[model samples]
Target: MPFAGTSPHEDYTAAVERVAGQALGVLMDAGGAVVPAGFAVADLHAAQTRDPDADLPGLRVLGSDALAPHVLRGTPVPSDRAEAAARAFAVFPPDAVGASPDTAWIVTWRDWATARTLTRCGLALDVPAPGDGAQVADATSWQTWSVRMAQLSSLALPGLDGPIHAAAREGAEALSRGLVRSMLRRDYRTAARIARWIAWVAADGVAVPLDLAPLLRHVRVFGGGSTRTVLDTRIAQHVTGLEGS
Candidate 1:
């Protein structure tokens, strides 16, 4: 049903929101408090008024977007959260039928994130290794490829480094074009993801051709407050020395 490893649009959006909220807290990076994630399932379930003991269909589809923040933070991860993240993946593996590159990349990063989160705590999660041919759709047209890369912006974390990170660094020019094009087209979410990539690559000392200050300023001033978009921008802000230094 639903082509496997995917959820309905409304439920998926809610699931992303659920994790983005946790991601925001970690992104805030307050002066000194230890930002521990809550117990496995969050208040979203309570908000749903469902049977807490039963796994909700939507929640099962959360993937590793739910754990990327904790994985990237390099902080003490609550055991339950790691286990919860593992369970979500167990229910919806990355190599499901007909999964898009966007969904596939996020899950690839999730496998990496869940493993890292648990490993940091001296634990292990049985995550499947991402297939070798994952997310390499094509790159002949950088503009279109940028859109594909934008979906994997969750990979923009400082702690997460791999070929994808290197790709963002090497493809800075194309990413910039994608960023500018998205801005012109008023696709703020895409713009936000590209901005996160710019900031991430910039952190690696790659001279991002775009002036992030004004771009970030515009995103803040004009980008409508979608939780997911806000989370991306906030991570960009944190990485670029705009906030949470």
Candidate 2:
């Protein structure tokens, strides 16, 4: 059941889960092109949402996921859903997101992902050159660096390439280290997310340092609890050409 909009945190959490669950549902079906259950296709843009601030993130997430099938193959997102995604793009400009240093790279990454998705949808927006913050640019340790890459799993999509994606590729060993460490400690969520980044790197024709197939399978088995977790593994599968494996 969905939570009442009790607080900003809860509202945002609910939106995240809702979008992840509905998108997951759509991905599960062979012929499921219909809009996910929560909102009518016309009402999907955040202008009609109860808490636009809280819900905009959800819309952005769904919109990003909506582009996957298209990016993976030639399947286009349905038109009404594409319109909803375009509207969400207009509202959530990345610069206004007020992210701290730890999260600024993620926002930048997501903005890049949004731009890629929208352009494919023929609803392109004007995006400025992304600025790299100190947190990502000056990281000294693999520990902090790996965690940041894991957090960026949402942007680990096909054709979502940029400076950070390049950085992830260059730092492939650190990311693999993190994934191995997380899996060793049984932190499936963190492991799954890091694995997603590694998969993204591998998909870009870069050589992966770790044996990816079993790692992805292990994470999918143990980490497939939350909707977002499952979503991460699903995208990782597609990115690695292991979708049916």
Best by TM-score: 2
List model 1 lDDT by residue over 1-245, tens digit each.
22235456655555556556555666566532222233222455353346431232333343334444555565665666556555655666657524675565556664565565456667677766655423544567888878877867766766667777777888899999999999999898899988988988888788878888788778767856465666677668667763334
How many steric clashes does model 2 contain? Answer: 0
Q: What local distance difference test score does each model get?
A: 0.64, 0.67
lDDT of 1 at 184: 90
lDDT of 2 by residue, 28-112 (tens): 5534323333333322334235443444567675547656655665566677666666666677666656678767767766666
Q: For each candidate, how many residue pairs have backbone atoms clashing (under 3 Å)? A: 0, 0
TM-score of each: 0.73, 0.76
Q: Which stretches of candidate 1 lie over 4 Å from their true place?
A: 1-8, 29-45, 48-65, 71-74, 96-110, 131-137, 242-245
Candidate 1 displacement at residue 91 in angstroms: 1.5
Best by lDDT: 2
